[model samples]
Target chain A: MSYRAKVPKPTVKRLSLYLRELEHRVEQKQPTISSRQLGDALGLTDAQVRKDLAYFGQFGHPGIGYDVTNLVDRLRKILGTDRTWNTALIGAGNLGRALMAYGGWQQRGFDIVAVFDQNPDLVGQWLENHRIRPMSDLAMLVKERDIRLAMIAVPADRAQEVADRLIAAGVRGILNFAPRRLDVHQAVSISSVDLALSLEQLAFQVSLGLLGSLDEDDD
Target chain B: MSYRAKVPKPTVKRLSLYLRELEHRVEQKQPTISSRQLGDALGLTDAQVRKDLAYFGQFGHPGIGYDVTNLVDRLRKILGTDRTWNTALIGAGNLGRALMAYGGWQQRGFDIVAVFDQNPDLVGQWLENHRIRPMSDLAMLVKERDIRLAMIAVPADRAQEVADRLIAAGVRGILNFAPRRLDVHQAVSISSVDLALSLEQLAFQVSLGLLGSLDEDDD
Candidate 1:
C-alpha cells in the first residue's frame, strides 16, 4: 500500500510520540501492539490511537492492535522524518547548547549540521567539532549547506529580528525557543517553544486542584 | 464569584495566551472584539476561540463578540496569571541565562527569582541582576523566596537529578527544557518542553501539506 500526505497536524504530532513509544516497544522485541498498549506508552487513549491511525487508512488489526515496526515506518514516512533532516541551531545558549548535545536528535534522524550565535566571544568557537559561526553566516550556511531547519534560542527582543534574518537566509522552517512571538512571512513556518508558558500551565493546573485531568489520560 | 480551582488544562493554556493578546487589545483601547477577530489575531478559527471561551461560561456577546477589557480581566482571573509567578531557574547554563534575560516572562506574568547551578565556576557567579547559587541552596531559596515554579535548563544527563532536588526543595511545577524525560511523583507536575519533537511535529504538518494542522494558539 502507498502512503498518503493528508494527515492532520494533531495526528502527526501524536504520531511522532507514538513512533517513539513504538521504537521502545520494538526494542523490547514486541512484534505487535494493541492501540491500547501504544496509547498507554504515549498518554493517548485506545480509541484516540485507533481513530488517529485510521485516518491514514486501516493500519491496525481489529483486536491485536498494530504491528510495532510497520506502524513506526508508516508514521516515519508520513512525518517526513524518514529522511535525515539537516538542522541548524541559532543561539548556542544553554537550551540550544543542551539540544546540540542531546542524543535524541540522531535517534530521530536529525543532524545538527551547523550552529550560529551573535556573540563575538562565542562565535568562531567549537561545539563538539561543529563550529559556532556568526549570525551573518546564516544566509551562506543555508544556501551552501542546505540547512532548512533553524532553531532560534536568542533573547526575546531579538527573536523577531532573528526570525526575519532566518527567513531571508532561506530557512523554510523555524523552531523558536525564544519566548517572544516572531512575525515570520507566510511562506515560513514557526513554532514558539516556550518553557515558561508550559511551567505556568502546569502551575495553573496544580493551582486549580485539577490533578485528575492528567490522570484521565490513562490508556 | 469565587475562583474555581478546576479549569481545564487546555483551557488554562489558551487562557494564558488569550490574556496576553487581550491585554494588548485593551491597551490599544479596543473596546470590543468579535470571536472571529480574536481568532484571527491568535491564528485560531472563530469556532475554536468561541468554544474555548464558552467553557468558562458566557464571556462573548452574540453580536459584539466580546468586550476586550472584560474578557481579558475574566481570563486573567481564571488562569491565575492576574498575579505574578515567581520562577526559579535550575542550571545557570546558556539556556537558563538566555531565559532569565528574556522579556516575555514579565509580559505573561512570570518572574525569575533565582538561579542554581552545580558548576563551581557558575555558582556564586552573577549574571546581570541575578546571582547564581549552588544546588545546596535550592531548598533555602525556594522556601525563603517563595519560588514555586522551576525551569530546568540542565543537560539531559543531569535533568532528572536536578528535578529530584527541585521537587524536594518544594518546587510545585516544572518546565523542563532538557531532552530526556524526567519521572516525578503525582504531586509534582512536570511539562516537557522538547524542541526537537516540536520541530518534528512542524515537519509533519508541512509534509502533510495542511496549513490548518499547524494553527497555533498562545498555549
Candidate 2:
C-alpha cells in the first residue's frame, strides 16, 4: 500500500519532523502553513523544507502555502505510519518491559503484539497484555502475528545473535536499542537508538557551552 | 580538563563513531588506519572523515595515516568521554532501571550516580547501586554530587516539568528519553532519544523496501 522514493536519508528524517509540526498545527485548528513558518519553527530554511517535501511530491501552493491537513495526510502515508504494524520485542529485561508499557507506539500505529526472551524465568510471564515467550517460539509467533518489524533490547553480547534470529525468523525491519552496531542483510532495515551515545553528545556540547539551539532532525 | 569547540553537531556525532571504530582496531592491535579504511568501516567517505577529524586538530600522517590508539584518546577527549561524568536519572520506572543496568555508560565514561522518582511508594527503593530518591532531594543531591548531567526517563507529560526542575538544580545537559519535545533555556543542552520515532522511521523504510544501506551518523 506504500511506495518508495529515492529520498535522501536526511530528508526522510525531516519528513517525520514536519509531520510532528503539522500535527501540532492541526491540534491548534490551523488550516494552512507557509514553508517559512514551518521551517522557522524547526530551525530549518524554507528552501530546505520545500526541497525535502518535493522529494515525495508537490504539496505546496504558490500563495496559499501548504494545506496543513492535506500535507499531514500525505506525510502519514509516505512515512508508512497511516496503518497499524504489528511488532515484536526481544529481551524481557527492564528495557523490554518499559517498551511494552510505552504509550507512544499505539498512538503511532505500531503494536508490540509479542515479547520474546532467552531466559526461562521470564518466559510465560505476562508483560502488559502479551506474555514473554521464549526464543523457540519467535518464528512461530512472528508468522502467526504477521510481524515484519522487531525491536532488540538484549545486552551488547547477545544483540548480534538475536538480530540473526530475528532476520531468519522473517522480521524485515529492526529498531535496535542495544548499544551495538548490528550487521544485517542488505535487504533488511535497521535503526539504532544508543542511549549512552546521546548522553555523550550532550556532554560534548555542554563542555563546549553549546546551546543545541537547532533541534537537529535525527534518529 | 575538557574544552569545547565550534565543531558541527554532525561531526561531533561522527567523532563518537570514529572513536568506537578506532577502539575496536586498537583491541585488534592494529597500529594505524587510513582515512579510507576508517570511513569505510563507518559508512562515511574518506574526505568526510578527514574533514570531521580536522575540525579538532591535525592527527593524520601523510602515508602512515592516523595512529589508532592516539586518535582514540584524542577523540575521547574531544567528545568529553575521556573523564567520568556524574549523571542523575529522573524516574525509577522500567526505562530508568534498564538505563541503570546498561553496561555501555561506564565504558564510555558516563556514570549514573543518582536515581529519582516522584512516586512515594517507589522512593527509597534500591535500583542497582543507587536508591530511588524523592524529587525534593534532586537539587540538594545534584549540588552535593556536583552533577551537571541528567537523564529524564519520566513519562511524556512530566518531562517538561522534570526538565525545568533539573535545569534549576544546576544540571547543564539533559539526555531525554521521554517522547515529548521539551522547551528549555538556551544555556542547557538537551538531546532526545525517542524510541517510537525510531520505530516509525524503520517502518517507513521497510514499507518502501528501502535497504537502509548507509549507516548515517545521526543521533
TM-scores, all candidates, are 0.87, 0.92
Candidate 1 lDDT over residue span B1-219, tens digit each: 423443545565666667778888988999999988888887678887887788777467788779887787776676677788788888777677666766667766778889889999998889768888999988999999898788898888999899888888888778788888788866576677776788887666556654332536422
When candidate 2 is compared with the true two-chain complex, its DockQ is: 0.52
Residue pairs clashing in model 2 are: A208-B4
| A22 Cα displacement, candidate 2 (Å) | 1.6
Judged by DockQ cut-offs, the docking class of candidate 1 is acceptable
Q: What TM-score does chain B get in every candidate?
A: 0.86, 0.93
The candidate that wins on TM-score is 2
- Candidate 1 scores a chain A TM-score of 0.86
lDDT of residue B131 for candidate 1: 80
Fnat across every predicted model, in order: 0.35, 0.58
Worst 10 residues of 2 chain B by lDDT: B210-219
Tens-place lDDT digits, model 2, residues B80-156:
77788999999999999888888778877888889999999999889988888999999999999989899999999
List candidate 2 stretches off by more than 4 Å.
A1-5, A213-219, B1-5, B59-64, B213-215
